[model samples]
Target chain A: MQIVLAIVIGAAFGAVLDRIGATNPTVISGMLTLRRIRLMKTILLAIGTGSILMFAGQMAGLVDVGHMSVKTAYVGVFIGGLLLGAGWAASGYCPGTGVCAAASGRKDALFFVAGGLLGAAAYMATYPAWKASGLLDGIAGGKVTLGAVPGSKFDGLFAISGDLLGIVLGAVFVLVAFVLPDNLTGGKTPAEVPAE
Target chain B: MTLDWKLGGVLLGLVFFAAVLLVKPIGVSTQFVILNGIVTDVVNPEFITQTDEGYTSTNAYMAKSNGKYAKNAANPVNYSFIFVLAMMAGAALSAFGRGLDREDKRLPAIWKANFGDTPWKRYAVAFLGGFIVLYGARLAGGCTSGHMMSGMMQTALSGYIFAAGAFLAAIPTAMMLYKEG
Candidate 1:
């Protein structure tokens, strides 16, 4: 039953990703280059909406903060994030979107998926070495919010309330999503801009 | 037809909400790890169990039966894996419905425009990049969807920090790779 639900939910999410141009490598790479802003707006808007819903749901008891799997803060996490970013820029596909693109019948995306799997396999093969390297050690707050805020039910880095801060930040993202131009340089449709 | 991004974003947010309501948070990287576990277990069950250290520890989620690496389809991690399959099906459905798969060329035009026409180079870079991203994601404990999107939604500090780091590197990397011709 749960697997069925997961399939439905995943399908809906995938459809959304495709519709928003996320399945397109050009759109992703273009956003990184600041040549296209549509994907950026989409991402920001999604994050904003998600933030509002999640935090608001928590306040309303509709969502459980404990259910969310929060990652620990560590030096390696930051460095790894940088590497992930560089990889995304170079490959034009993150893990999620790569699968989506492949499903959309892009052969290049298939290669990307194969590469990702191989890469992951390599990582697994060397898991012990990485573990011993101390890069994965040194966790900073295991699960934190903003500012180590007080009177807050959730963990954070700041002294502000988690819900309040999340909602405010979400609103800001929504605003920015609306404010950014759909296309930075303009005039060409997304499809027309690439591979004529 | 492509739905507007704002609407798509809203729908995606709703999906996240639904995921939280029904199961654990949404993420993609762990599925790969689970796959790795399956592969390794098949190749040599003793490989992962040889050293009970770090992630490879016997009690680790991937090594245990009821854990993320469970071969059972009903397992939660496997459910996440199923979710990835479902995502692909969803994208394929959308593409077919929209005639997106009708295009003859598989290679992205932007890549060719910038890097010239060499399939080998493109594939090589793609494989290397994919490997690095997965490696980094494992080190970081998540990817954009896991750490940045869902993490931020939960107001986790690591999410924001990871987001900052991702953009800090991504923007510059794109600039360096795809300069104006």
Candidate 2:
């Protein structure tokens, strides 16, 4: 039953991603280069919308907070994030979008996927060394939410309810998405390219 | 017709909401880990059980119990795997419906324009990038979707911090590589 639902939801998510031009490497790279803002707007809007919905759901008791899979913060995560960023700039596809791009018939994306899997395998192969390297050892906070802070849910950082803070941030993202020009810095829109 | 991203974002949020409501948070990195486990199991059955020091297994997550991979509640071939497959199917369907599937260009225009027409260079860079991304994602315990999106939704501190790191690196790295030529 759960498997069937996953399939349905996954398809819907993929379709949305593709529709938003995420499956196109040019758009992705363009966003990174500041040559285009459409994809950026889309991403910000999606994240913002998701953030609002999630917190709202939690507040309304419609969603289980425990179901949220929060990752642990560590020095390695920060360093690894930098590496991932460099990789994203070079390749133009992140893990999820690479799969979606491949499915959309991008041959290069297939190679990207192969590279990712091989990289993952390599990590597993060298797990022992990495584990002992102390890079994975220092964990800052594990599974902590804004609500966990004292005084108020969002009092720690910005001095508001954590959930409200998320919503406000989300609103800001959406606002930016709206305010930004379609071609902020001007670049070839996907429509300008001849269909292959 | 291009779908409005705002609409897409809203719809995606709803899908995510429904997903969390019905099953669990959405993520793709773990699927790779599970795939590696399955491949390793097939190549050398004992490799998975072997420990880093022979006393403690290097990958306890891949350990089997009663002839089944016992870490995640949903087996590799089950939930996450199927979800990935469905994502592919959905992308393909969308492409087909929009008549965008006819394009057979093996390389993206921007890549070819800036990096030159060589296929090998493109492939090597892509492969290296993919490898590094996955390695980083694994080390960090999640990818953009798993940590940045889902975690941030719940107002988790880790999510914000990770996002900060990702953008902090990604923007400059991109600028360095694809600088105006």
Candidate 3:
């Protein structure tokens, strides 16, 4: 039953990612460079919107706090994020987007997948060193949420209601997506592209 | 036809919301490690072995989590792995269904403008980029999906912190590489 759901859910997620032009390297590159933000706007809006819904669902009793999975906080995760960002800009794809792009017939994405697997293997080969480095040790009350929910095992960083916090943040993203212009760097819009 | 960008965002959010609400949060990068484990097990049979307790791996990392990782590697036909496979299928269906992602125009326009059309170079860069991203993701214990996107949605502090670190590096990196654009 879960496997069937995974397929349906994964497909819907991938289809939506492709439809939103996430599978396109150009748009991703454009967004990162601030040359174009059509995709960035979409991303902010999506994240924001998702935040609102999930939190709202939680408030409405439709979402369960127990199901919420909080990743452990550690120094290495922060450091790793910096490294991930550089790669994202250079490659124009994150793990999920990269997979989707490859699946979308982008031959380059195939290489991306290969590289990712190799990278994972590399990490696996050296996981002990990192673990020993103390970077993986719990930080900032590891596995904590911003607000205490009624039932989750994770701690809360603040006494404020997490659900409320999510809605506000999400609304801000949606607002930015609306107000932000299509192009930030004055790149050639589709209409402005020189004819071949 | 491709959905409008804003609408696409809403839909994407809804999908994520549904996933989180119904099951677990939507994450994919961990599967990369599982993939590596599976392949590693193939080359070195002793890399992973079944035991009375359950599956175990010679590698300490896999052996952690009480052999859960090792179990998944030994039996790759699990939920998350299958989800990843399905994600690819979904993208293929979307891209190929419309026949829109044609081969000839594979190289994106901005890339052409910045770095002439050299397929191999792009491929190499992509490969390097993928390697770096995955390595970092593993170090961070999540990727854009698991960390940035899902983390932020759940209002986890690490999510915000990770987003900061990511953009702090991403903007400069993008600016450095995409000078032409």
Candidate 4:
């Protein structure tokens, strides 16, 4: 029952992402280019909204916060973030968006997905060699939470509180959707678009 | 016709509900360990050791110190990992079914000019990018999934910082690439 629910929910979220023109490389790239802030706004809305809901749910006893996982590795995170950013720029798709794009039938997305899988496989293949020198490993902190790590818990509380903010932001996104006309994305190239 | 909001909504609802029901939560970082186990099993059996060092057992360094594989080969595809994979697949199926399957060809002029005809360059770039991301993900102790989804869900401070880190890198990389394009 639970697994079935999981699939159904994920699929729906994917659908919304697809409909919103999120899976398109052009749209995501546009966010960076400043041609379109839609993607950025949506991401902010989702993060802001999602966090708030989760917090509220936990506070209400509707959700179990302990089962949730969190870890802190400042060095690894800082570096990994740099790499992920570089990759997203060059590839025009992150892991979530790539999957969504592929489903939307983009050839580039297929490459993106293939690359992710192969890259994952590659990481595993090299883990042993990388691990041998202890260059990649660091002190393991069990499950550091807002309470455990450095930094004010206020921000953590703010994230949950942001749920109310998400409502306002989400409405704004809808407004942007209306104001921005379609074909803001240039149409398909001659080769990509099928001839009549 | 109404954006299938009902369908999308129901599915998303299910994701949250199901997560709470089964895995007690959902996350993506564990998938890396499973992949590591599978790849290690196939590529280098000698890499895995046999020892017990608690959570450190999963750390590449501690694994070496304790004499065990960084990822427990005994259970590579843990139920949680499988759940994450399933979520991706489920989302794919739903989106693809709606006739939304098409690429947006908003290529930056440079890429279009230099490698427009060839897909391999982009593919190579994508592959290279993944390598960098995984190495980072491993070091970060979690990918976007574990940190963003699970960590944030728990209201952990690191989750927020990691999320910020991902965006911080993402914004600049996007700027450079798109500008070049």
Candidate 5:
């Protein structure tokens, strides 16, 4: 039953990803470079809207707090995130987008998938070393939220209601999305600018 | 035809929201690991073993979670794995819906402007980028979708921090790589 639902939901997610220009490396790199920010604005809007809906849903009992999965806070997580960002800018595809792009018939994306598999395999081979380095150790209370939510098993860093905090932050993101200019560089993208 | 970016974004938000509300938070990278395990297990034939207590892997990473990862790799037909596959199918469906005559079919315009029109070069870059991104994702225990998008939505502090770290490096790296336009 869940598997069938996964197909429906996953399909919708991929379709949305494709439609948003996420499957295009050009759009991604453009956003990263601040040359073109239509995609970034879209991203911000999506996240903000999602956050508002999710947090509000939780509060309204429409969403389950128990299903909330909080990743362990670790130093490696931060470091890995930095690495992923660099990769994202260079390749213009994250894992999900890469897969979607490949399916969308971007031949380069197939190579990306191959490389990703190899990378994951490499991580598996070296997992013990990372584990030994203690980088995976949870920091600041292993799994925690910024604000406290009533039903979740995780702790909150602050006493404020997490649901409300989420709503506020979400709103802020939406505001930023609305206010942000199309291009931080105040010029057309490289493709449109023409070679000098 | 492609949807407007803002509309697409809202739809994305709704899709993510619906997934979380109905099931578990959406994740993709872990499936990469599971795929690796499945391939390795197939090759070695002894990489994973189904025991009296479920499943276990020769690799410690897979052995964690009481062999939960091992189980996924061994079984290979569960919800998460299917979700990832379905994601691909959905993307293909979307592309087909777009008529395959979309602009930037082979190479997007901006990528060509900066990197030139070499398909192999783009492929190499894409490969390297995918490699590094997945490595980092595994290291961080999540990727953009898992940590940044879903995590922030749930208001997890790690999510916020990961987003900060990602942009911190992403922006500079992007600037360094493509100084044109």
Candidate 6:
């Protein structure tokens, strides 16, 4: 029964992604070019909404934060983050988006997948050398969460959370949504863009 | 011909449930192990020694290593493969419903002109891209599906990192390759 439900959910997610034009490389590229803000808005909304839900769930005792697995601290993660940011700007589609794009039968997505697979294989082939390095060494601290932060990660994070930082940043995204000119937009919905 | 959002929803739900029921959970990162195991066996079969009672075969080795080298790896007949297959089927079904599956001659023309008009380059690049992502996924210990979707669902910090890294990588890569005419 659960299995059936999962499949349905997965399929729906794909459909929503398609409907949103997320599977399109142009849509994603538009976010960076400021030609399309829909992707950014959609992504921000998803993240913000999901975060709020989880926060509320935890406070209400409906969920436990302790059970979750967290990565040990690594400088590599930060470097990887920068590389990823650069890659996305260059590629236009990340893994999920790439998969969806491929499913949609888009040809460009084929290259995206090709680049991704090569990157993965390269990482594996070089893992032993990397693991031996001090930079990638793992710290003992495990299961860290936002609640532990002295300054909230959410703060200045689009500015809507009651928490001062969250409210500030959360609000920025909303403000950007409202104030940015259509051309200068950081994110927009699929309906806002011209069709490919 | 319109997408039945409800049907898409049902298929997604089935995939997740099927994964949990049969293979513990759904995430694309695990596929790396299967690929890795295959590479390992092919590259150096002598290194692929039997470690457990249930999985004493090469096939078992492939699945087990892919799943965090988990002992008692989930059955090969699990839903990950099935879910991917179903996704393709659903996409095809939706395309057919929309009358959009018909071949566009121009599509091939674009590919021929840009991608060297050779099958080998296309396949090689595809394989290389897959390899890169798998490597990153392993280094990060998860993929976008595992770390981003599942990880964020659980609110793990690493999930955020994974998501950030993936999006970060994707945007630039696309621009470099796809921005041209």
Index of the highest-lDDT prediction: 5
- The superposed Cα distance between candidate 3 and the true structure at residue A43, in angstroms, equals 1.7
Per residue, candidate 6 scores C-alpha lDDT tens digits across A5-121 of: 435554655555565445544455556655555455554444334344444444455534332344444556545555544554444455665666566676655766666756755
Per-residue error for A179 in candidate 2, Å, reads 2.7
What fraction of the genuine interface contacts, i.e. the true contacts, does candidate 4 reproduce?
0.34
Q: Looking at model 3 chain A, which ten-residue stretch has the lowest summed lDDT?
A: A187-196
**Candidate 3 local lDDT, A104-138, one digit each (tens):** 77878888889988888888889999999999998
- Stronger candidate by TM-score (1 vs 4): 1
**Residue-by-residue lDDT tens digits, candidate 6, B1-181:** 3223334333333443333333333465455454445455567765344555433334432333343342222333344534543444454345444443223211322223344456455444444554455556656666655666455543445666666676666655544554322
What tens digits encode model 2's per-residue C-alpha lDDT throughout A118-188?
98877767766766787776454455666542322232333456666767777887788788876655655
Candidate 3 lDDT tens digits, B1-181: 5577778989988988888887888889999989888888899999999999998898887888889989998988887888888988898898787665354236656567778888888889889999989999989989888988899888888888788888889888887887664
Q: What ranges in model 5 sit over 4 Å off? A: A188-196, B101-103
Where is model 4 chain B poorest over a 10-residue stretch in terms of lDDT? B101-110
What DockQ does candidate 6 have relative to the true complex? 0.23
**Ten-residue stretch with the least lDDT total in model 6 chain B:** B101-110
Off by over 4 Å in 1: A147-154, A183-196, B47-77, B101-105
Candidate 6: deviation at residue B122, Å?
9.6
**Candidate 4 local lDDT, B20-119, one digit each (tens):** 4344544554454555565655676655545455323433432543433354444544455445556556546655565542233323233553356556
Clashing pairs in 4: A8-B11, A9-B11, A9-B12, A9-B15, A104-B101, A104-B102, A105-B101, B49-B68
Candidate 4: TM-score? 0.66
TM-score of each: 0.87, 0.86, 0.94, 0.66, 0.95, 0.64
- Backbone clashes in model 5, listed as residue pairs: none
Error of 3 at B25 (Å): 0.6
lDDT (C-alpha, whole model) for all candidates: 0.75, 0.71, 0.83, 0.51, 0.85, 0.48
Model 2 spans with C-alpha error above 4 angstroms = A149-160, A183-196, B48-74, B101-104, B179-181
The deviation in Å at residue A194 for candidate 6 is: 4.3
- Candidate order (lDDT): 5, 3, 1, 2, 4, 6
